[model samples]
Target: MKFLYRILFDLNKEIEEEAIKEGIVYVLNYYKNEFILYIQAYMAEARWLNNNYQPTLEEYIRVSTISSGYCLITATCYIGMGNIATEDIFKWLTNKPKVIDVAIVLCRLMDDIVSNEFEQKRDHVSSFLECYMRQYNVSREGAVQEGRKRIVDAWKDINKESLMPTDVPRPFLTHIINLSRFMDVVYKDKDNFTHSEGEMKAFIKALLLDPMKI
Candidate 1:
């Protein structure tokens, strides 16, 4: 525990020094708070696992979306983003506004759909499928069907959110949507991230090697 505490201390000290040098100290607490929420989310999942406790879909989503780390990732994206990443933008993100929440929720459900079987083979915590199935008393396929339906609904919500006029800037919304798209690509029909030898390799090659046509 002492070693762990020292490592955490060193990480914070490093981030604080960098943030100060970059004149972005205003985002430091936001980053730290997001990390705290991320850690607490994992701890909640662990406790549920240890106690053999099953959460309802709503309860599971509440924690799982934080565990998705989208908020933390977004905060990290803003750390050195210069003038555009105002403190107000960070505050907006921290409040868990509707659009970003839908994005991460889409990410979480898509991941669970593609990864639940492999996760279940281990001593992992119950995934979204498990929670939904348990709550609704549905079969595995039924749960999957329902999960996909929710994902489609989330995408519809995201589309509506994007099309409507809003106070938030477009870049931030686009960035969050990009993160969701990444999750969708990596975990759509399979765990493409883990089994990266095939399509993922091609994706990288296309992204890096093959130049775009003009």
Candidate 2:
């Protein structure tokens, strides 16, 4: 597992370097900084757990949850930055409003999984979809529909705001959809070893790539 962790860390560094070379430096830096903070937090939690009680499956889940939360945050940041940077060299949205929304939801899902409050049979999709739905104050089905709608709407808004209409292409949108699909598949296969370290490294690499290069 230590070897696997090192491989993942090295792959993450490579991805960050790639993003920086492509002029998405801020995104890579932001995520890398966040990851460091998360690691510190995880270490602190582990120390407390070690001192206070016997290690259990629950403790293991907490550690995994922290790692997963960091992964999702960094992944989303990479995607958002890569998308914005691909089209315009200097035209970047510093706010990243949509990405923030998604991150909050993803974090909540991670929390539920870590705390053992998420029901595999009943709450997986519900918890995942809740982020968008809660933001819009809509039902689960409504939220799913709204989430898709917002993605399209956001594209249009970006087109209007950027003034370079053709800069961000449809393939970028397709990539995001594909990424969401992959996340769904992974969540569904949580019981199985569906994700390998190498696969995750590849996914991060894909996210870090410039859309034109991809």
Instruction: Report the number of the highest-TM-score candidate.
Output: 1
Residue 122 shift from truth in candidate 2, angstroms: 24
Return model 2's CA RMSD, one decimal. Answer: 10.5
Instruction: For model 1, name the residue pairs that clash.
Output: none
Candidate 1, residue 203: CA error in Å? 1.1
Query: Could you give the C-alpha RMSD of every candidate to the true structure, in order shown?
Result: 2.5, 10.5
Per model, state how many residue pairs clash: 0, 0
lDDT of 2 at 146: 48
lDDT of 2 by residue, 178-210 (tens): 444455434432422233465555556567763
- Deviation from native of the Cα of residue 99 in model 2, angstroms: 5.8
List, residue by residue over 80-137, the lDDT tens digit for candidate 1. 5755788899999999889888888898889899888888998988898888888889
